[model samples]
Target: MLPYACAWIAKSKGFGKPRREGGFDNHDPRAWLSRLTDWQARANAAQANSFEALPFFIGAVIIAHQLAAQQAVLDILALLFVTLRVIYIAMYVAGLPTVRSAIWALALLVNVGILFLGWR
Candidate 1:
């Protein structure tokens, strides 16, 4: 959802313009996104990273569930992960690399915690 939102925001700017006139090329969305500059480009990169992060997050949740980890704790960690990712995306689009990387690291740790939640 976040990724799509970022893409939409990026593409939205070009809405109503013909693709030949430098409008977003829905026919070649990836190519169009790759050509983006500034915050829009950062947003696209963030979208890619968000997608890259999803599998690990999903796996951690599934693992914790399979191990019967406490739902309350798992839920909190998952929520924190989501919150951090949102911050990360904002930071990315804002060109705050240091802050974004820190948030990314924190989110990764949260995912690790989730993975270990049921490791009694």
Candidate 2:
């Protein structure tokens, strides 16, 4: 998905404007990377980066469980995390801050739900 986003951006920016054909042009990877980094910054500021907090949340759930874990709970939380992440990223990147913040909250709540359900 990142590659696709980068490729789309490159194409839009006319990385290979004259050719307009195949083969990815190496037009300053850092530039593209910087754009993504900037997006990350925006996302972070907008609270649309809740997905970035999932790993630690999941880790906490795992540790809280310790043993006798339930796969169903994990699966549900994982699905929620991924779904909310995709939505959050799309909305945040598209400059919809309000919607993005709502999505971000939803995703964070999902993580909290996971902790509550999984830890129990």
Candidate 3:
């Protein structure tokens, strides 16, 4: 959902502007996106990252559940993950790479913590 949100933002921002070879070419979306150099591009990059992060996050949650993690802790961590991701998206789109990287690291740590929630 976060990834899709990023894509939607990118597309919406791209709609009225042409950077090269026209704008938001649905026929060749990848190529069109690759040509972007603004916040739209950042959004696309963030979308890609969000997709990349999904499998790990899903796995972590599943592992936690399978291990019988405390429900409250798991839920809190999941909420924190979403919040951090939203901040990460904003930071990326705003071109704050340094802080964004920190947030990314923090989010990864949260995932790791979630993964170990039921560990003895």
The model with the greatest TM-score is: 1
Candidate 1 positional error at 55, Å = 0.3
Residue ranges of candidate 2 with Cα displaced over 4 Å: 1-51, 64-67
Candidate 1's TM-score reads 0.95
User: Each model's C-alpha lDDT?
Assistant: 0.92, 0.58, 0.92
- Candidate 2 lDDT, 15-102, residue by residue in tens: 4445334223356644543444444435433342343464667675785476545878767776877687778767766778899789
Model 1 weakest lDDT span, ten residues long: 4-13
**Predicted candidate 1 versus true structure: per-residue lDDT over 1-120, tens digit per residue:** 877877776677789999989997889888888899999899888888989999999999999999999999999999999999999999999999999999999999999999999999
- The clash numbers for all candidates, in the given order, read 0, 0, 0
Error of 3 at 92 (Å): 0.2
Please say which candidate is ahead in TM-score: 1 or 2: 1
Model 2: what TM-score? 0.57
lDDT of 1 at 86: 91
Instruction: Say which prediction, candidate 2 or candidate 3, comes out ahead on lDDT.
Output: 3
